[model samples]
Target chain A: MAVPEVLLQSGVSSLLNSINSVIQSLGVSVLLPIIIFLIALAFRVDVLKAARSSILIGIGFIGINLVIGLFSENISPLAQQMVEVTGITLPAVDVGWPAAAAIAFGIAELGVWMIPLFVAMNLVLFAIGFTYTLNVDIWNYWHFAFIGGLVYMSTNNWLYSVAVGLTLGLFVLVAADWTQPAVEETFDTPGISIPHGTSAPYAVAAIPIHWAVDKTPLGNIEADPDAIQDRFGILGEPIFVGLAIGLVIGIAAYSNALFVAESWYAILTAGISFAAVMHILPMMVGILMEGLTPLSESIRNFMTSRFEDRDMAIGLDSAILIGHESVIASSLLIVPIAIVMSIILPGNDVLWGIDLATFPFFFALMVPIMNGNIVKMVVTGTILLIPLHYISSAVAPLLTQAAGSAGFDLAGRGLITSPVADAGSPATGVLALIPAPVALAVGLVIVLGIWVALRMWPQRMYMVAGASEEKARETVERRHTGKGGGLLPNKLGSSADVTAAEGRSDD
Target chain B: MTTKNILVVCGTSVATSTVVKEALKEKLPERGLDIGTIAKAKATEAPGKVSSGNFDLIVTTTQLNQDKFDIPVIHTTAFMTGIGQDEVLDDIAAALED
Candidate 1:
């Protein structure tokens, strides 16, 4: 039902006006939020040091990409050209360099591809493992990228992508340490520190060939199951395969979508989404560059930095988990949201534009949920789909069609397809659209759910955390026993201190 | 009394950086930090300005490419905004005794 014009309303026009004024007044000082954030993290903000590092890494990566963009429009082409110069290529027949990078970017951004990929990869791996009876089971390499895709792709969003990359990078690093088996285990270097210098070695790989090789040999191997398991479990090969398939299909559809010959919005949205993905996960080139060198030290440092602040790291972990769940649940609401949007889209088609990309992306996320209770997700998806057609049908006619039988523009009724103005107007630039009250609310639910999930960890993790502190205590203790250990006496503490530190979110 | 000052900087110093700086000022004092100059720190002058005599430390989410720095510089993750605020303050407070 249309909102009755009498009761219906638009955002306070003054508020919009003031926002524009504020944007103007801030001058370029507006850049300070992220800038100050970096500076604050560098100089003032006292926690989540590793997360700070992740942000820097991501921002730095993007900054570089922006510079690279200065020279080229499509990053994939540049990535591919780099490969030809290197004289190497990824062997995966069906999936090539451009597609791989695009797939990585897609998975990292969308969180949708993994749904189908997860199912298919698992089935194929086990079936092959079961059929071949192979001990070197054909699975488990995608510790970060897979999860990046499963969690980040589908939605194909930026905030979530950065959030996921940082959270995942930090978690893998910390979890790598926390979950690493004790001295009793065979491999007891204690710290599988992935040295510093390189940032998110896995996610940021620009070359496709380097992408797979970095993981294939396992240079910095650690002894553990939880992290390794969780890492692989969430992402696994299912995601890679899924994204690979999705791209072929998505690209084809996207190509078709390009031709749908509708408005610029559809084409623009798909183009932007696809382009963003390619930059993130450039294909075979990264794989070709693969090999272990002195880079381990940098890798270890990067990982350690990733988990520098115990407090903020956990909080971010909490946030990512929430974002994940939000992606899951909000995904369920996809159809409903789309239904509502379609109504608004068509009538206002010529007049204004909403960031409707979220709708189709959300629809894509349901692929996993679709597998669960296929009927429910499908019903939800359709309910969402019907609205697009509804609004399109309703609005198209209003702009050009007569107002006879449908009564879409009736007097007693509220605004129909053609409302007077866009609610989200003055929303120029990607920045303007971000902090989307709507997206944030959904993110909050994800956070609430993550807090609930944090409780489910086994008591052993508490033991592990205790063990961690005791281990640190031992280092501190040994330091006292000899030299440097006692040096930071004021700084170091025992298992209790570590646990206390871990529990507090205040960094 | 030495002002436990910090310089928050980023490219353009626009919106997100401001939110981050304000958040720092609001929270830093409680941690025994005498917060000052939460203004825009230009990327070009970021290190030279921050590492000079005034501020005790530099906390930033932006990536700085310098090989070495005079003062302790913490780079925050853009992905994790306001994440390292408290720890950053504490580290600076720890640095004051030096």
Candidate 2:
């Protein structure tokens, strides 16, 4: 059964061309779901369920993209206006996460094999009891690929890129595990973990920093968003807070316009736009969640059943985690801080633009470390941004080079763009710069040290008291079951209660 | 039948409020209640908005300080997770009827 070598080569080339054509025609929105469906089939999930889940994921991505689009459209103008009014010209324009992800996905060397390889690695890690997270946010695989692509370009070697990428991915999974308990405690939800590209690693630094802050006299001062809301009334609400901040930014952005006869309302209009964003973005997220929940639920259920003895969490996007009021409020506070830091923080050249909209996402994990205290969260977030801006500036050249290799034309625009514009700030500045093996070893040691420290002094790291988690669950259940306010009808006890009950008992 | 004004509140008064508002729209009509205006506010806005304006009921996802509000406050976590939704609607119906 000998086949000619030339014919085999031709057949292989044709098959690759066909895949490339399909990918080009459909793009990620359509291609991702199809890939998910095929993977689901490979996993032996029921055809109908797999198809439903795939379609749901596609819808979720679409919903998320629409929301992001709306947010960018609304926020970008104000950011631009602010830069114009202030005369703050930075050398680099942050192309933000979408562009960065595009560059990562466009890398020909990592094409098609990325998700499958990562999944295989995840399964191996799971089987070996190395990680509790089953990473389902396949779309975000670009983060790892981005690192790999960067390494490959730098060294002109595929092995280095692959090594760095896989190492970074594994490190994120471990970080997800490390932060899960705090996420559950802070958010008061269970059965999920966030392994987002940028925010997850920041949590490692945040934990130690927050611990230090707790020792200060400020520790007793609980200025959380909820507390602020209760105390300050309207000023504390995200909408009003957004309005006030937006007004300041608008006035600063349009100072010249304001002095002119026709543009007096520009500042007020800016405030209204920001206020509208406060209302609109979350609703969009809610819509996106409606699509994501079904998929996460199916995955969670399957994993829970499969791993009967062990507690398993489906790792999802940070978008799922950012819906908390405190997180949003804290992020709103950070926006102006980030802007101020960008200007005053020496050696920073990246201009704030579309990426400012991602502040809520950036602070999602940090809120937990601060125990949802807005005051502490703001302080820590502000301090974090100092390094972030510098690192973003530092990586501009590499990012610009990568953009060129990936086909983004920067020669004509007079602006270099950094992919680290949003999520990769911590990565470039901290872990990603190190040699792969060294980074992996250091990451593991630090994680282990923190893990041990958490075990020894659970309260120090914002670990929930055992009794409180139970109490919280009971409170939720009692309210649902008609023992408390009985807000829920008696018969259809919610899936939330069932899940809460399951989580509480398992612990 | 007198027109009833219901105020729905959540953490940010955006995402969950929209969901709750939509849910109440369907449920309130099902209960055969005459509804006038359905409004949404952040939980912080409840005290001022509730005190200044005449509202029949306040439905919130977050637990509110009922003593500060003159109107009945119904607290439910149903809006965020879409769980225990029937109970939340039933409770809303009961609050409106009362």
Candidate 3:
């Protein structure tokens, strides 16, 4: 009788607690907006805008994190490492909060693979929104929320931190452009920028579908997103060059005796190497294509999905989601071609200084988001270097300590052995090979650098593009106005500037 | 022939330098040099980890002032990354006139 009574009380208490938690969440989501509306009714629209912006920011944070958590789960080795951290044996779960957040952050970044694209997209959107008086503050609101979401997400969804940093960098660049109204910005709120002559109906549909437009005209070419997608599509120039860079690295690695053994797979070493280095997809393609390499398939699948979605959104054939997988594999042939040069002159030491090489690699990876602004990318890179260097230094020693006798792995120990943003794994499995002390140091620095870079890169590009595009639109307006006076952005940070160049990053 | 050594000076002069030193020792015989290849245990700033007169040649990523050493020096972009490792090695061989 006594045991049954105690059990009953405990169950009742838990049920009550869970109910209260759900109620609190619902209240915050529902009541908070109503309260803000009441306040807006009494006060100014700016304050109400501020409240609405905060809520959207909060929601964006929650949503982005949800996606990141989902995607990060798929990184097989990382999941193993997380289990190691907590000393738990359960496999990481997808289709849940964790993986969703990871994917969202990764998708939002859109820079790690194509930095210029990220920059151009944000700039184009900001320009359109600001020029037309759409919900302009959503830009700033999301930017700060990203920073905040990043703080939360980094601690939990460690693997996505690198992508998060890229996102933040882009956000900062966009935020810089929000001073006053362009000739098009009749309204000040984000997403509500009412451009000259475009009424309410057009602004609502234009903001989200800015880049995903179906059929745009030449004079109306700013909305010609099909052209934008083509700029960075699988057949684009960057993927081709990247494949060459990979082939060079692969052949160099091979001759250096990286392959398991010469007695084994040497039939067409040159051809094989090129195929492996196929630079069509950086970070994912080469890792995935390797047969024996230990990178997890799930994470690779996610990357493949992201690249596909990106191609789709930018106006590639929306119907073909998984079609680009073949493109990634076939394009890998270029890596082998460039790598053959190494065999001809195998005597040269092809190593670059770590700082010089990786800084650029990071910047190159970020160039899409910065929209081909090498100067802008460099500025962001420089700002991030000191902190990143210190973090790497600190993490190295700690990793040395944690490594014990397992041989401290440097970069490229397959995919799962490494952490994104160098997040420390749960204290078991693969990451356990990386000692806790070193992992901590690496984790902090890597995450910080990635997040900072992401935000800075995109933010600057967006501002420049938005300002420029506004000018272009005005000039077009003037020409039509019969005045024929001068009024184009004429430089970087213009509104239409975003669409003018989406994937033309030289750096 | 006088006995000589080549020191690959780097920033930390630890892990990567160690790897370079080992790779050089293995690869040098092919170039017909029986001389020992050692990683100088110093950085560009504190390159005095090994004695100045101790090495017959200095190889580094960045150039040293050479006011302190009489040995032949060859610097290339190899120590920090894997980019020009082979090219830099050829440069060193060329410096040796072998």
Candidate 4:
């Protein structure tokens, strides 16, 4: 039901205005930590500890935002300059994840209801034993909103938007449960699972492909960074690789630099910047994880105390997992590849504007799915992102429309494209390209399939996480014993023992 | 007196290395090991990095090509997982003494 125009005029408008003002004034960095603190208090955490964790979480967000800001500050201009120099107008300006979030939250029709609706949905699911991932990363709800806004645009019905949004939430919760075992096993992070907007859907897409890849003789080959280093030596180091890729992108981006000196400067700066980004971004991730540790611990304690039989997984931002080596290496390598994809892929109309920050977010799960195989990740990442360009290009018109409706001033900009929302997000593309009713029907099938899968093969659903525990132990042992050089080891154990240990998530 | 150089390697040289770096900073002084330059690099970068033959020891959480690095290499997920940390520290001290 559409909220009446008169009601929107009165107390509702004033209330939402007041809330938005407060949110805008305090900034997300300040607001999010405070919210976390309040949530911790509600959980009956000790005041001092809660306060510390909240502040630290806030600081972590600030650090991440600052790094993103730094990255965008350097790269966004380079991207725009590339467009200007190359005269390659792709018909959509890639506003990126942050701008996409702004468009999402700014929509009163969607933003006003997303949090309450999802929280209620989460509770209902948990009560019914459908999902165990307590999704506390409310800030990322924009991802859901982005999809709903598209559905709404397609159907011209607010109800469809709400339905799709709620459905997406339900899907993510199920996806979280399905992937938890892998998360727990792989990252050695026992109590947490990622229900991140970008990673979960990609995880679903990657599953069958990974299965297929494993079937091929290519599956017998192991090509993680360590293996690649063993094979290619210096070319395998992320720094050198990033340098070479960045130089190519920089030269291409600055192809029309007027002076020879200016062109050289551009090439050198881009090379160094890409190298620095690959190196430093993980440090920022480390800081972010440090802040989250206390809160995760407290929540783990509180939940375990309540449900002793259950091993609850706290769903967090996918950013936490990106600190891994394969994730960083894959994302860094794919940066140039994405640029090349945009240039070479025929019928592609998106110039991959400012959404460059979303690359690491994109690879959050793919790296793990590839089992830390850098070679496989790049191959899969390229294949996965290729279709996204077309998908995002198709949705660019609707996205721009939604942004315009959300009170954004896009008077001059011709067509705005969101790399993440368009093709970058598998979920959004599914919602945008398919008719609303058909999409909803398909969504139902998938959700039901996932639910049944969770019931029948709860252990198998999280196989990635299952293998992680062994991987972790082996990694520690091999590294400690100085037995590092060789082809990648096969799946360590044949027994059902490790999968039995994965039985902890049965609750 | 030669100042020993230590290279701390993690897969990304980010999260795990930070923890390992902190652990070394705390333990090395107590173990009577004077640190010179403690640097960080990705595990994949270890071979090319150490090829200069500059560092005295390599501490990493990921597997590396140990034969390529002439220096003593110690592998422990101790900093991240808190398992076998003492053995790692003891080895670090022994390597430094050597």
Chain B alone: TM-score in each candidate?
0.70, 0.89, 0.69, 0.90
TM-score of each: 0.24, 0.62, 0.25, 0.61
The lDDT per prediction is: 0.31, 0.61, 0.31, 0.65
Across A8-41, the per-residue lDDT of candidate 4 in tens digits comes to 6777879988987877667545665576667667
Cα lDDT tens digits, model 1, A1-507, are 556543344446666778767654542212222332343343333445434433433343333233223213332332233234443221111111122122232232222222223323323422322110011100111222332432332344555544443333333233322222221121122222211101112111112222233345332332332233234332222223233323332343344344565523533443454434333332122221111101211222333343343211111111111112222333333423443443354332221111121221222222222222233433444443433343333333222211111111122221212111111111011111233344344443533333222222312232332234345455333222332211122222223343355676444
How big is the positional error of residue A365 in model 4, measured in Å on the Cα after superposition?
5.6
- Assess the local accuracy of residue B45 in candidate 4 as a C-alpha lDDT between 0 and 100: 66
Q: What does the lDDT read for residue A265 in candidate 4?
A: 85
Candidates' interface RMSDs, in order?
Answer: 19.3, 6.4, 22.4, 6.5
Candidate 3 C-alpha lDDT tens digits along A223-269 = 22233323434433332343344333334334435456651243233
Off by over 4 Å in 3: A1-5, A8-150, A153-238, A258-507, B1-98
lDDT of 3 by residue, B1-98 (tens): 44457886542232223435645675666777666546443332223434546666776533244554566766543322233557867776666654
Candidates by DockQ, descending order: 4, 2, 1, 3
Candidate 1 residue A370 C-alpha distance from true site, Å: 41
TM-score of chain B of 1: 0.70
- Residue ranges of candidate 2 with Cα displaced over 4 Å: A1-15, A40-86, A91-127, A131-200, A211-227, A230-258, A261-289, A311-333, A350-375, A393-428, A433-441, A448-507, B1-98
The model with the greatest TM-score is 2
Q: Model 4 compared with the native: what TM-score?
A: 0.61
Candidate 1 local Cα displacement, residue A138, angstroms: 35
TM-score for candidate 3, residues paired by index: 0.25
